[model samples]
Target chain A: MWQYEKKLQYPVKIANPNPKLAQLIITQYGGPDGELGASLRYLSQRYSMPYAEVKGLLTDIGTEELAHLEMICAMVHQLTRNLSEEEIKGTPFANYFVDHTTGVYPVAASSVPWRAEYIASKGDIITDLHEDLAAEQKARTTYDNLIRMVDDPDVLDPLRFLRQRELNHYQRFGEALRLTSDRLNEKNFYSFNPSFDKHCNK
Target chain B: MAMKERIYAYDFAIVEMNLYLDTHPEDKDALCLFHQYQEKREQLIEAYEAQFGPYISNVNDVQGDKFTWICDPWPWEYSKEV
Candidate 1:
């Protein structure tokens, strides 16, 4: 069960509010590579995970993605909070507002909504764990690019926190991949189901 | 409780239960904990719907009302303004 701490994991303070930059950065909030999809991808993939550790890793990292989702939403919200309809509509945010009404929606910068196509859940422990590792790297790269584009230290603070988390999750996912590899029969990959009891997999 | 924060916690708990159960499904004590967590989740969802808005997104269509709850504030509103 979750417990709320009544405070941010880290505080977000924008010395300035730039709705235009907010519009672009929000892609990380809901974009294909964004935190929301990452959380959903891992959480939903846990069902068929062959090993307990992989399933556990998905859950922990998925939960952290949810936290990252909160942080990204906080960034976008704080960036756009004080803008007027005229000001918001006047800038790049105008298109976003037309679609989401300043809501923390999940969409790419091109205005494409997030889709299940963003990530895959292969279900095989090795395959899924590998995908998770790659997902973390992809997300880390996205954050890196966003950091380059964003000049605000206020924005960068949380971005740095998020980047650090991505590194940690990557490390865990890498560990999960290794564990899954060890579980696989060194002889062959075809008979992954020979040992475990089928009736009790659930 | 603030609606969004409570709902967030509720979802977090569900995911937490799902994860714990993934590893400890046979533990009766853990199962009990899962049930307790779920019951609390149901209560919170109801409270959130009654006080704030529907719990699901997009609950307008007749078939849509099938989902019952929709559209709480997004998570960012609960954060302190930067």
Candidate 2:
């Protein structure tokens, strides 16, 4: 069971409200390589994971991704707060404002709504772990792109922290892959699907 | 506010260490560090809750006649003074 903590995993206090920047950052909230997909992918994949360590890592990382999702929402909320009518007239955020009206909605920078197809949860352990590793790298790249375009220290601080987290998750997933392989047949790790082939040697 | 930030730092360290220990379960040094952070985190949370109401909803930190759980300035909301 999950309990609510009335605090963010990290602090997001942005003094300046930049609707333009918020438009870009909202992508992380619902983009293809977003936190929502990352969390759902890992959490869903855990049921099929054969190793206890991988299962625990998936649960922990998935929970952390939820926190990251909250952080992304907070950033978007702060960046769009108290926008004047004139501020919304010609900005890129005007289109979004027409729909959400200062509310944070999950959508890519291109305005595409979030979709489950953005993530994969194949029942295969090796495939899933590789997918997770790639997912982390993709998320890290998105953060890097955001960091490149953002100059505000308030925003940059959290983005950098989040980026670092992606790297950490990637490293852990790699270790998980190694651990999984270590427990498998050294001759041909792919000879059988550990998650499905129940009769295979444990 | 500084106290809250410190608590966040400690909590983050604990979380990072926890993920590490999940895969490297046999690392005694990492487990020790995780426990140390956990202890410090508990102390900081106690102090923080005493001054700033409960950080989680289940805590019994109410004083007079108010339910502080529904207090303003949720995690997402920004305050200039903060």
Candidate 3:
């Protein structure tokens, strides 16, 4: 059994209700490259990962993504906490309020609803590991952008925490890739899997 | 604390699952933990529905007569309620 923590992995408090910023940040919640997709993808893909280290990395990163999901939801909630119908209808939040009424709905800034296409779950370990690496980098870039767009200490506090997590995840995933590569080397007794043929035999 | 617990349970499962899988990828120990976490998650979800009205607004699964016993009373209404 896992123990629960009362505190967020990082503190998240949004003092002002900026629905527009919240709407934009919702992209990190449910966009194609959002934390939701990131969490689900990594967690689901772990079983087939060849190396135990890589599998562990997926689980760790995926779990953190879940926290990120909550942080984003909190942001959205704070942003629209007291939004009136007229206020909501006057801004892009109108689209969200029509459906969720202050509730967080996952989607990119482009308004594309959450889709499974965001994740790449090839059964092949090599392909999947490479994809995981790229995904971390993508998320890091997104956090950097979010940090730049928002300047509130409340918002910046969580954003900074999340950005640090991105870097940590990137470093871990990079190590995982190395571990997987080492496994391939030991199994082949060769320098590398040049053709990618053996591992690609799906 | 209730909302935080819900999130933590899910995250705890993810972290524990990864750690277990790191060494015992198929040890079944990790799988057992996975099941435990999932069950806890269901209980938390029920608790959430009971207290917060509903975690998801459109869904009403609290009526026991209906097959939607998924909702449990929120923490404030726990047996420890004042």
Per-model CA lDDT versus the true structure: 0.70, 0.90, 0.69
Q: Candidate 3 on A9-63: residue-level lDDT in tens?
A: 5445566778888888888899877889999989888777655577667777787
CA deviation > 4 Å runs, candidate 1: A1-5, A189-202, B1-82
- Tens digit of per-residue lDDT, candidate 3, span B24-78: 4566866887878878877776777677754432344455456343343322111
Among all candidates shown, the one with the greatest TM-score: 2
Model 1: which docking level applies?
incorrect
Instruction: Provide the global lDDT of candidate 2 against the true structure.
Output: 0.90
Share of real contacts kept by model 1? 0.19
Per-residue lDDT of model 1, residues A26-78, tens digit only: 77767878898898889988888767777677877787787778778877887
Q: Tell me the spans in candidate 2 whose CA falls farther than 4 Å from its real position.
A: A199-202, B49-60, B80-82
lDDT of 3 at B4: 44
The positional error of residue B15 in candidate 1, measured at the CA in angstroms, is 15
Worst 10 residues of 1 chain A by lDDT: A193-202
Better TM-score candidate (1, 3): 1
What is the TM-score of candidate 2? 0.94
In order, what are the TM-scores of chain A for the candidates?
A: 0.88, 0.97, 0.86
Clashes (backbone N, CA, C under 3 Å), per candidate, total 5, 0, 3
Candidate 2 per-residue lDDT over residues A58-80, each given as its tens digit: 99999999999999999999999
